[model samples]
Target: MHLNRALQVTAAASSLLLVSGCGLFSDSTASTAGFNPPNIKMQSELGPAEGQVNLIAWAGYVEDGSNDPKVDWVTPFEKETGCQVKAKVAASSDEMVKLMKTGAYDAVSASGDASLRLIAGGEVAPVNTDLIPNYEDVFFGLKKQSWNSVNGKMYGVPHGRGANLLMYNTKEVSPAPLSWSAVFDDASKYKGHVTAYDSPIYIADAALYLRETRPGLHIQNPYALDQQQFDAAVDLLKAQRANVGEYWSDYLKEISAFKSGDTVIGTTWQVIANLAESEGAKVKAVLPQEGATGWSDTWMLSAKAKHPNCAYKWMNWIISPKVNAEVAEYFGEAPSNIKSCDETSDPAFCDTFHATDENYWKDVAFWTTPIEQCLDGRTDVKCVPYAKWVQAWTEIKG
Candidate 1:
């Protein structure tokens, strides 16, 4: 937990970060903020398991001890609930969205980028939290967020979260950087040694920084960007791109770049910093003063779920105290269940990740799919959508 660097790794969220794959929606269908989706009625009550539940998930999420004998959590759930778990490993959110649309699966461990997509498209149903008893133990901060809910109704159960922290080579960064400015306005100081998270969502990091630095810009939420504000953030990133040596999408790539001094400073998750430091990179990761952008992947039930009862059972099982702790530690993220903190093998794990600290996440804008209707709830102006963000990202990179 050095420098309080703790996080999750190698999941759909990780791969989602590397791709510009938030599907495009036209202006007509873009404003999903408060836009009422097709009402897929949630299950009012649970019944006997359907014998099996097919799931689409990130690599490490739905384990069966096949990967690591000691890491299996799914087996016990099957034994307890009598519902067999068949999991498909997805590499990215787009693939997850595609998989969900086919109605081949009952549930998905969706990342922030895809949760809104699923909800807006009516691919997932509203969660009946009343039926899931264990959900009450989940960290209060992880509940009722923009990505996992719509129209004040919950859509999924939060899995875990990790911040996009600022990592700098201790040997190179003089005077110890504090804010995101080192990678933005002062990026020229590092020249080609600077690095950044390689995703269109990265625009939020710039917008987050601008929110603190340029108050007159009146940027309320990083994801809720109007045309002028979005352009400013893009311009800032365009300038930073010049100083950046590489935009890293993989954890190992970032570690290697930092280890070889190819990147002296840039965006990183806690686990990436730990791995890089362990590999002999003089690195330190910190949740900077301006806060950061992060992801809290959710366990969502498909709208067309064939095993509705089993899917509900799996959702409840995954976030149960012990299983939540095991998965959170295994995945390298802060457990969503507050009770899971006590069950974690590392007693200080929750502390390291700020799992229950609402103040810590106050400025940390969890990644949300930006829509035409402003997420910040501005009625007068039409905000940019994810489609435009993707297009702008491609042009900025060019």
Candidate 2:
């Protein structure tokens, strides 16, 4: 699912508010200290739960035997847990939010944008880290991010993360694109041949560029925009629209474009880059010097989950080194498990995906779906709000 369209599904349901600025803390301070496990607990010697657990997740997060048999993760999880697993695929954040509201799902593999909404809506609850034994091993940097935690209470478990890289066919563009400016500011060079993710959430990518290139403008979080910052991002995108040959909401579409030599340079994910290469396309997921937007999908339990035991079991199974490696390679994102990359069958997977590599992470600005806090380290009185971003996005795409 395209990131922007995913966000649009939830735009009408909620508006972004201006959150109070608090002093930022490193990951060390954010870690849960002696946290209690969730109200439901499992026996150490017992087998998996003997019940059903429903999950609302993205399209490729779980495999139901439709894709390659090796790609199936849910069946093994169900077999190990002894819990019947029923899965629902959500293409966008908005769809996930709408589906979650029905209270039928026990857990959700939420992106940063939907995680905040689930927490705010009281649809999800804080995870009991003690029960999730593997939680301790999670990277410190990912443990207590702004979107996953509220009042120091964690609402979800970190999974995979990756940047929205500038993917271009090297055969078409020799030097390789280095910055977002090439796509956003000078798109005419590839006019009618460029593609970008279609959704409102993408406003953040534009905001990131403005924050670095035009600090004097004081644009903070793209979602939490004021009038000026909102206009600036919208204006920039409006100019970019003319150069866009297509606004892609589906992964296959973007991949097809790249394979057919339709799209020369545009926004894409790591998985697309890998797939492009397998298909014999000279594509590279470039980390522009200015930085990039990324997504960190979190596994969260529903507040009113029917089968908490099974949910916890699923969490453990999903994060294990073996399963983590499979999902990471299948989905094309860096694994959260530090050791998972080593277990992957593809010897070059780690180098290609940059899993467990700190230097690679530093080069890209991991996607932090805009919240009210304005994550750009702004100490000013205020920053752009979410409502403005929604309105501006509509105008930019219209």
Candidate 3:
């Protein structure tokens, strides 16, 4: 619920900023640092084995009939490796977890929330970069990320990332809102017409705000809420509930809500904004002055993966510049690969999307779901943990 509120505030404010020429800007220094070339290896220490790789991923992440036939990124890898591909589409983190339990999926494109769950559950295995020849080419920032690594053992390959931006319809709202306070503290401007993402896990967004705005309050992890932090986030959401038009999980629903003028401001992703624009809606994704929360999806290998070699092959193929660019374009997120961002067909892609811009990146306070310890900066004590966040989410939704 806190997460939903955070998103709602973000969506409403972002739409206002974009129309006022305050949209995201590219970070040249961060882009250059992110794009630095990885040390290349001539061959994979682990050779390709004969098998099929079954990947559980989001829709449109793999080949999804949207791109040119000649430019399909996965075809070359399939042809060269002789590894058959079986892709299953999953919509949410919960669905991904259920699918992984079957032991049929060899790999998955897991977001930060699900990656740790998989690693902790022993559903995924630690990656051996040496076995993946192109692993050296991956950006160092991605390689050593906290979400994909546990105690120095890496669990997955970094794919793409984006913030849960604040976006809104410019024609409907005026005097662009600058901070979350406008959306939460004073939401009367668009009462009964606002919306938020309908996911229980979004409570972390609330914790992020408290961490920045009320650090002295001594709240623990936002996801793992103590009575105090939980009350704070929930109180914030209860107030927000009055302003929401409806809680949404599907992109089509959000897009339709925005297009029909049924909803003016709400929580959204860059992909949703791109889709809305293509559908002729005057919407824009924004990064507020107070910052926003986000996630990075990683490609993780199954612990009992039957096609380890094929999985590695797929990982190597997807992270390449050309393939990374194609995926980024399709998903509407900034590519993790610096080279891939450079090779994108549209010269203005990074600038428009704010992918490689340091100014934009620094402005955002990206979301990394709180785990065992609290992320709300209460070092003096450990408050409620992520397990609690999961439980509280169920109660809040109920």
lDDT of 3 by residue, 61-145 (tens): 7883445564466666778888888899998888998899899999999987787677667788878877766666554445555
Q: Write candidate 2's Cα lDDT for 76-141 as tens digits.
A: 777766788889989888789888889899899998777777776778888877778777656555
Task: Tell me the tens digit of each residue's lDDT in model 1 across 7-118.
Answer: 4323223322332132111111122355677889989999888999999998789999999999999999999999999999998777898999999999999988788889
**Winning candidate number (lDDT):** 1
Better of 1 and 3 by TM-score: 1
**Candidate 2 deviates by what RMSD?**
10.3
My TM-score estimates for the predictions, one after another, are 0.90, 0.84, 0.82
Best candidate (score: TM-score)? 1
| Number of clashing pairs per prediction, in order | 3, 8, 12
lDDT computed for candidate 1: 0.85
Model 1 TM-score, all chains together: 0.90
CA deviation > 4 Å runs, candidate 3: 1-45, 64-71, 219-227, 363-367, 375-380
Lowest lDDT 10-mer window, candidate 3? 27-36
